[model samples]
Target: MPATRRSSLAIAAALLAVAANTAPALAASAPAVPNAPMIPSGSAPHLVGPHGEILHSSSSNWSGYATTGAKFTSVSASWVQPTATCDGNDSYSSFWVGLDGDGSDSVEQTGTEVDCSEGSPLYSSWYEMYPAYPVNFNDAVRPGDHFTASVTAGDGGSFTLKLSDTTQGWSHTVKKTLSNAALASAEIIAEAPSDASGPLPLTNFGTVDFTGAKVNDKPLGSFNPDNITMATNGSTLATTSPITDSKDFSVSWKRSS
Candidate 1:
């Protein structure tokens, strides 16, 4: 059928408008915005491998020792929760000891969180099994408190997470159960937790010394673990402070972002 002159003119005009607006519409939607930091949540970060396995990247927000390929039944570490400066907005970080979640789907973990909420430094303790939300404990953790935390895996997906403040002679423990956990890697770490937007900025915890790090019945040195330094965009975010013995180590905060 032959098109009418008026109908042909309308179609041409519509096509021209569409082409003129396409690039502008795309440009409006494609710019990336900076993400603000928030409190920690959910599973830790990893880059998915081609084979569907999790792999570590230098840019990750974790600095610590991870033992891979070994089934970890238990992991533990001790550190003095450092007093953090809350000069910057939305600054946060966590010091923890955990099994799994370094490269797999599940984490049985517990530790202390140092976060700046509205310019005030806040301290607390919490535990989480991945795929489920984390829970904060009622126990008070002050700056410079000596903390010892441990996580142990048990039969039928049961697990135990314990946190002790040896400086204050206070301790809290919880037992919970999870399903289909991989039990892949064990870690003792200082982490900038993930938020709805991705990795949150680590708080200025100054220097955190980790002592008595152990997995199963062996010290961290016995496993030939990876000493991780968290970085991003060619800048260092955190670093392993030092160790007189592998059983004891530290992570020093470099920059918040």
Candidate 2:
């Protein structure tokens, strides 16, 4: 606290002229920005302007008239609308939700039970109607029949489903359906369904909603539905149940010309 020395020589000459103009602008911009594409300074690609308003990347942290990232803490539009486009409309983007997607055009399920033992049944069932148009896990669903399927039961039963399985010639998704309208000729006269025979072909797997029913595929001492009814037609698929009072209940098929 002696003499002032003229305010510390004018703040040391303004800190040496701001360190000589920041070291020559960082040595002439580090060799013209070598290895560029480094937009990572907290990842930047921000576009959410306003006049019409549009900027969205929310994990959820939006608040008030100025915000960014992790979330802006909490505040929003009551009268600040601007989803972007005073007049440049044309945005097409959204992708995910497609594992045989569920746009449902023909995926039926039904029931109207009264099983006196298996003869008072009226039912319907069809799976994979529209959402199954994405085949080719190995291509081969395009045989002489073009992937067929069928199941009609209850007094005039019907069952047909020939996807070229001279014994696994290549086709599977009946991985099991139906439960047993005699299980389609006892697994199509038993065997060569392309080799691994016996258990699969249990086309009559009735586990949809009647509570229980499983035949030749025998999940364990089968048949248990007081009643059921179902339907489908992207070509053909039906089911009617009665279980056993003798009004005739059991159908099957495989046709899709």
In terms of TM-score, which candidate is strongest?
1
Instruction: Flag regions of model 2 displaced more than 4 Å.
Output: 1-164, 167-223, 231-239, 244-257
Tell me the alpha-carbon RMSD of every candidate. Answer: 16.2, 33.3
Q: For residues 149-249, what per-residue lDDT tens digits would candidate 2 score against the true structure?
A: 22223223222221222222443333323222221110000000000111111122222111112222231112221111111222221122333331123
What is the C-alpha local distance difference test score of each model? 0.68, 0.18
> Which tens-of-lDDT digit does each residue in 27-144 have in candidate 1?
1111111111112222335455565543444545677667777788999989997888877375668888888865665667888877664455657678777556566675567788
Judged by lDDT against the true structure, how good is candidate 1?
0.68
| Candidate 1 residue runs with Cα over 4 Å from true position | 1-57, 241-243
Model 1, C-alpha of 40: deviation from truth (Å): 17
